[model samples]
Target chain A: MTGIRRDFQKILLALLLGALLPASAWSKTVIGVMMPGNSAYFQEIHQAFLTTLTAKSSAGTTFEIIVQKPFPDPVALSNAARKLLAADPDLLVTYGTSATLAVLHEKSHAPVIYGGVYDQFTAQLAGPRATGCGFKIPLTSLLRHLRELKKVETLNVLYCSLEEDSVRQLNELSELAKEQQLTLNRINLKNREDLKKAPLAKGDAIFLTGSSVVAAMLDEILALAKNHQQPSVGIFPDRDEAGITIALYHDPLAQGRKIAEIAAQVLSGRAPGDIKPEALRNTELMFNLKEAKNIGVKIPFQLVAEASKVIK
Target chain B: MTTTPIANSRIICRVIVLLLLLLAVPPLAFAQTRELVIGIEPEHNIFTQMEEYGQLVKYITEKSGIPIRLTIMSRYGEVLQRFKAMHLDGAFLNSYTATLAIDELGMAPIASPVSLAGESVTRGIIFTRRDSNIRRIAEMRGKSIAFVDPATTEGYLFPLALLKKNGITDIKTFFSHHFFTGSHASAISAVLDGRADLGVAKELVYQRQVAKDPSIAAELVILEESPPTPETTLCLKQDLPADLKRKLIDIMLEMDQSREGMAVLKTLGLRGFTRADKADFNIVRQMAKEAGLPGRTSKRQ
Candidate 1:
């Protein structure tokens, strides 16, 4: 009986140490977020994410968000990632595909969560310990608007080859176009300069997705769209200010909040895979009627009634 | 250091340069072209038949000032699936399909077909053998009833509405046996074959039969006709661009007076499209909801 009691005591001590050691060892954790440095909006998203995280966690839970700027810089991103791993974050939240790849190559036990990314399967960004909103912009809404406008058939879209976001969205849109039996013509813009000269096809409307390259060239893009007498749509709401016809946009603020919620789940010891990835918290369909009519497109009142916002 | 040209010659040269500029910039640049794709079921070859019926394609283009193209889908299920896949911009859809579109696909009806009488609604009629004893919907209890495919707007949806209105649910309690015939044509065939004691169809379907065989009408009397509901209409895919979608709606509502458009209208059995609010289809959607057939579910058509 004494031998049995001694064995049980040893087992209990071992278990206590096993749980305590890992908990105590965790400190000064760094959370890496990959984002575009060129845009202030992404900064706002990062700020909201951190604020929400700090607000929710127990006081004195120390963590830092390390944002790696302007993705697709493999070497610099790799170095930054290594530094982050050395700091040893409890988890990593990747902003987009470019950022995700950089973090993925580095060997780290930290769980990964991809934020503000699209085409989860094709991108292969749903890495181990990966769970985040796939953040797909509403394609159905755009198609529906086109149908309502009596312009149902073909579309012309411009993409930046260097921008992963544009490539990702183009692939998804092309797939949808094939299913709907509409033709999608791709116009690749190599740089901001190339964007200005890209020919606008007759009988085609312009569709673009969220890419810093696209965003920076918004003035030129809008001019091209207007010059072609084509209605244009962007994937991000911010693009609306830059003069796209409208944006079928996903709210980054909501996306940030969602990421915070998922991060909390991971911090609470939930298995990342067990936490099924969530879609964006909300998506809105917006239109610019002023822009529409300028391009000779008539706006339907019924569609306006359902819009989150319409710039008339 | 440059010498001035003669005034008349310079003026001519300037005029030529201006003409070249005008020619270089195509007039099409001034025309706004908004394009979207609408998916339609192959029923009656409505999408392809648009050219023959109303020059629907040309009519919409002239009315909306935006060219429209119709893609004929093989089945209603394909329509919903494409909508989900974000493939279609809009669709010409039935009330049943629209119900699913609104709930699941985020689409809303902008316009629906109007009958020759200018009535924008249709009804479902539950019928039985005129010589048989089933006189009312309740008499349908303990009798085998035939339904069209569970997704059909009329044969399944409207009959279900009539059943619910009469406080006769628990389908098993009312009918000893039930089966779906896949379409209105199939359900009518089932009734004619004596395979089922009761069946459901559109009210207009019964009238059409009366023209071909008056005795057929005498053979089956309407057990119940559901309240009038909206006819099939145009639906925008949930995420279509708003301004552009609006233009499409405008095109549809104003298609009546155009000569080429009128022919398309006649074939679809309508004058032209009418403006619709979400409230217009509330009755059908509400009834569907009450009958516990809400959304794109297995029990719903």
Candidate 2:
């Protein structure tokens, strides 16, 4: 009788273990995402990430996403990063260079996947627990496009000198201009009120950099440039929708998909450091014909034809 | 008769539990195994085609409550073979293959892509480099011509039939040489590189290419445009349940109006999808017959 009782107890224990094993194996993966703000660009990247993650999830595996509210400033970003790290998520996904830097600063063990960063090298995003994709519009391509639109003998670039990424981009543009034998005029925006005081000369086209201050003050700058009849080019492709004559940038949707693929690799047991961070390869060109006409620039048929999107 | 009342109650309880357990098992098993397999013709590389159609498959899965598995067949014939084996639950087929599937495999035409202009038809174009001395189809008596693929309707059949109708029959002897370049882009490249004096492609692709490189306009000239052909079709297996078929057609037809659906359509280079039937592809059948392609109706007629 005691032997039979022992056998029954063993069977019961085995059944309980079997039930718990599946529950543990099927538990959904938790991904915590930190975003800079709810800007349209960030939202697009977020949407692409969700769409791709859903599409790539395996049959039995599922995902649970925890998103931190948009951090408006550097302090807010740092606080959010600390709080998110406290949650002990399986992985962390961040957007923009500042937010990514904040997460890296936390020094969490969770793997970090980032997107929409301008320069990953300068951001120092490569580490044992982090990998990301960057978007950098090559200056040579932008200048070549500008040269095709009009004979740009002299180009003026307006940037906020405080931003390191902006300064780097300015230096790159200046070097590229030297190679092309075109004169580049550097204009510094010390503050918001400098837009009205900046020297705008006729026959000098404007080059917009990837600067937050410049983005915040784009409307006034564009109005000033238009008033001066200076055809302007921007780094963000969607800037064309806001009246920039020519905008060149990497495809954000593709970038999001790339980040998701890397995340999938990490989730499937690959170390994050094993995956090398990549820059976006596919570039999209946008042209605003109406802006071209307003600026008294004739966009060549070839440039107009090659554009991925055109705003009239 | 001699059993106690408590023993009878226990027996009744055990019988009821057994019945409940039997009732739950079949549904769990069915849910675990249910999946919809969709086959697509490889117009582009498999990865790209999958990426483009990813959202469409997801949308279908969400609406139909069925998991969708996509299979990209490397060739047109492989898709037909898989359908005959009953391995595919549905397929996205070109007009010719859709017509064949409807006639031979009992497939039902559920939906087809429509252009942004609200047109459900596409045209084939024959083009040559502007510097090429060949002016017309008749002038290409001894020049090499490039075609996308023999199985491609607009890229091969329509354009070839147009040439034959213009009295350039006996292609082997009429043209010095002809070759299949495997894709419309390749055919265009072949012509531009001067390997072939003329090439044929779909009008929409040509226009998109020109839009991306206006230099094509300065270099290549459209020599002829074929008559309009019906667009590609999304087909369903006839054996699918009536309610499920209705749900799928409704989801596809309403795809473009929603944000997620619009993204899928844009990726697939389509404006939207519209409900379709077998009658819409009669023109494709006629074109196939004219082109002398081998299929059920072509063989029968």
Candidate 3:
């Protein structure tokens, strides 16, 4: 009889233990922000986002932000995202198309906040769980500025055919042009020498997207622009020093901070899908005044006032 | 006991109905708050213009939590159309457009552009193809000339006015052909391309072109320069939030010293922002009034 009583007591203790556990453990929200491996801009953006998260979080509800460098291939980005998902993060933060796509592949149950993406609808990146900021680099503004600088009918963009990032931009700009009844004349140069030999015609403007392949030929490209009397504009901020007339770009650090805020909102129990993806709230338009004079194009006062930086 | 049970059932029903009502009303009230959209035309040539927006966006958003979506329009006319449609929450308009936006569209100027000299002004210049024999404003008659956007101060307003004031009333009669190239850079390029005999543009833009392509630079000569016009400015929507306005002004005033904030400011090309009141635009208002221009009405292209 006593043995039976002991078993009953043990069963009741076990039942009580099970009942005492929380209805569900309050989760540690995990935020994964994927970025490029070799960029100070990306680093600064990541650090700023993390700093904001640290400053904002309160006691009891802890959050973790994972900054992953996706290098070599897009698949690497996917793999990193999957690895992050294994931890069951409450939310995901991503930047640019490459990293954003990688996270999308996982089809994360946790809400995903995206940042640094340019034109979500055009890029087809507005996923079910994805909502954050978009890259608001002024494509129309850049083109219009180019028009004001000079009436170059054909804009020749030097792009690496293999790079998905450049290809994505090439496609976006292509679509953007269609809406405005404009044309982007493309010159696919496989090597530096080929870029030099790309056919130059009347009414041509050379536009360089930030590609290492193109960056390798910076001086040569500048020389080509000068020789043809064609204005060259790049999309990278750091490349302004290399002689591109203007660069409509933004700080990746600010981008990261923006995405982090979205992530924080998700972690704080706001629905990710409910949180609309934000476009880059801040952007800087940089112009090399020396390069402008070199290209023989005069800038308007309206444009000069709009520039974030004027490098003379 | 029967009365007690009936009363209890009624009370329970009331409690249940009240719970549903509470759940429905709070969310509906929250949804009623609308988003204010601000349109920005990215004038990337100058940092101050870009920085002003950054400071303003941060200030306004921080204060009101309202998201500002920048609808980048290409030409000056596009902005006017949007303003006419009452689509803009606010806009950063140039003096020419500011005049039009104010006089015609009811846009109130809140700020204006300034230079290192602390003078809020810029000018337009007419440049001729170096090979063209037209060397002076009088000689420009019967020559092909290109003007940038009609709303452009340097590109259109001041340049055209210079011709009108100089007794060359009809550009078409004076110039063999007149064209609107839509921007100062294009105006200069028309001459470089040999498509136009003369071009009207902003002086600094001309300087930038010369710096970029000396060959093109060699092909142009400054034929005339116009008097200065007020810098472009932030003109608010008719009903901008008072708290948001205060926040934007505060942020603009404080932007220079804020470490993280300055980077965004530096992106938009300004040294630093200072406070300006409605009276600051008295010069522009008086100038427009003197020009026989309505507050915001634009001279058609």
Candidate 4:
């Protein structure tokens, strides 16, 4: 009888405290962000998104952001999604295609904001209640730029089997390479250990797909490339000085700004379904002339002139 | 033997023939056999410079029927010295070095490469970030500065002259720190990234960077711009055969007229070459004079 009376008294005391406190004391908007990894591209997007979101915030509205940087894999990404869902966040933000899908698979009610995914519609990652910005870059022009730097024979493609978007990019390049009459050597990097299996060789170039796995192993892959004197091109511009001989990709700044716009609309009580998704086509083309020189290749002037940035 | 006037005449005739043959052989051989060795000044990228000059040299050799070889100087200031040390027949030089080479080495300006925009002249610019609070020369006092190579007019001499004209002498004390960034692009980068408070670079390079990255346009402002100066000019040795120099000038000036020539010009990121006279370098000479650069060093060029 005393234990039951004590439990009833505790519940009454919590109800009284809740009634006395302001709603904002416990009703802060919580946003959870799922990142595939700490890739420079994602970090740039995330920073810009936060800055814009903070600036656009209303007078009294507050945000509580929970960021989860999970190792780029299916299981970890799903676990990250479940953890975020458990928070009952008002919105879920995702960077990279893998994380976006993992979050979508959980059937959450919160609006989803996705960024840094390559070809969102083509990869079938887009869905209802998901309004955000994704990017599309021309792989043909990337190959053309690579060819301008050197005569590519057996183009080595570095991709991860786990990343759906990465696999989509690789498959796209493979089809294009066939049309161009160029041979391809696809090296699948499933995890960290697979980085050592890449056969970095001479007289050919490496094409790095937008896979988190490849990005995680970029340093070692580029080192092997440099050690073997094989030039490389990539879809991601890592810090603008990844020793990537050629890079052509959408600007992270543009993607981030667009994402923040969509997110602000959602925060303003608009339906995610009402806000139409947009695609970013503005791309940045860079040539690492220094790396080219290190590998004993001279980028022609005509092509150099075309690059948006040349690291001389 | 008996001394005779006829025998003496025959000996004199033979001597005259031998002397005439000796004189004729050397002139003919020098005119035909000697290959022209040209020097390329150090630029932002050696490989780029080499590829550009290499394609031009190959084209010129094929067209002019004269063997031409290219050599790159170790640095920007060695053009005139290497002209003597390496027996350089001519060189493609920026306005600063071209002016110095003309005044000191007696080199003649043959032609200048027109930019892809068809501009044969470039200007010097002093720039800084809008937020850097370095709007004027007075504001640059005690601040860091990035200057391009001393061998470039737009990079170094023009800025130096402007500062002296503003009465800010003794740069060592005027600025807390100053160093050469070696390229106009580097100087612009230093200013944009806040590595330096002020930067002096070629206006062409600055514009090129702005075109590449639009954010640079928002971040930086041009504080000053010098009068137009000659772009890279082909300055040939004074002793080169007049015909050879004319042939080179004609080939470059007429490059855009033919398909093959246009292809080569495209490779070098140029529209074509235009005639450049010593008078075209007057702007550079005046800038150098204002900066008090002549005879500043024993190896001035």
Chain B TM-score, candidates in order: 0.74, 0.83, 0.73, 0.85
- lDDT for each of the candidates? 0.68, 0.75, 0.65, 0.81
Encode model 1's per-residue lDDT on A181-216: one tens digit a residue.
778777787576676556666447888766666666
TM values, all candidates: 0.50, 0.47, 0.44, 0.51
Candidate DockQ scores, in order: 0.02, 0.01, 0.04, 0.03
Give the true-contact fraction for every prediction, in order: 0.00, 0.00, 0.06, 0.00
Best by the DockQ measure? 3
Model 3: DockQ vs. true structure: 0.04
The ten-residue window of minimal lDDT in model 4 chain A covers A194-203
Better of 1 and 2 by DockQ: 1
True contacts kept of 2: 0.00
For model 2, how does the per-residue alpha-carbon lDDT over B206-269 read when each residue is reduced to its tens digit? 7766776565776688988877777767888887776677877888899877888888788777
Which candidate achieves the best lDDT against the true structure? 4
Lowest lDDT 10-mer window, candidate 1 chain A?
A36-45
Positional deviation of residue A100's Cα in model 4 after best superposition, in angstroms: 1.3
Model 4 lDDT per residue over B1-301, tens place = 6979999999999999999987777532565567888888765556777888999998888888788889888667789788777778888898888888887888899999789987999889998767556788899887878898888898899989999899977899999888887677767755654456788988877777677656577768899999989987889988877877888888888999999899999877789999988788778777777898767322323
lDDT of 1 by residue, B1-301 (tens): 5556687788899999999997675433322354657776533323334554336666677666766677776555567788767557777776777767766666767888777888888888788766456786666777877786566567777777667777977787778778775455445545643446788876765665565445466557776777777776788765555666676677677668766667778765677778765666677676677677744442322
TM-score of 4: 0.51
Residue pairs in candidate 2 whose N, alpha carbon or C atoms collide under 3 angstroms: none
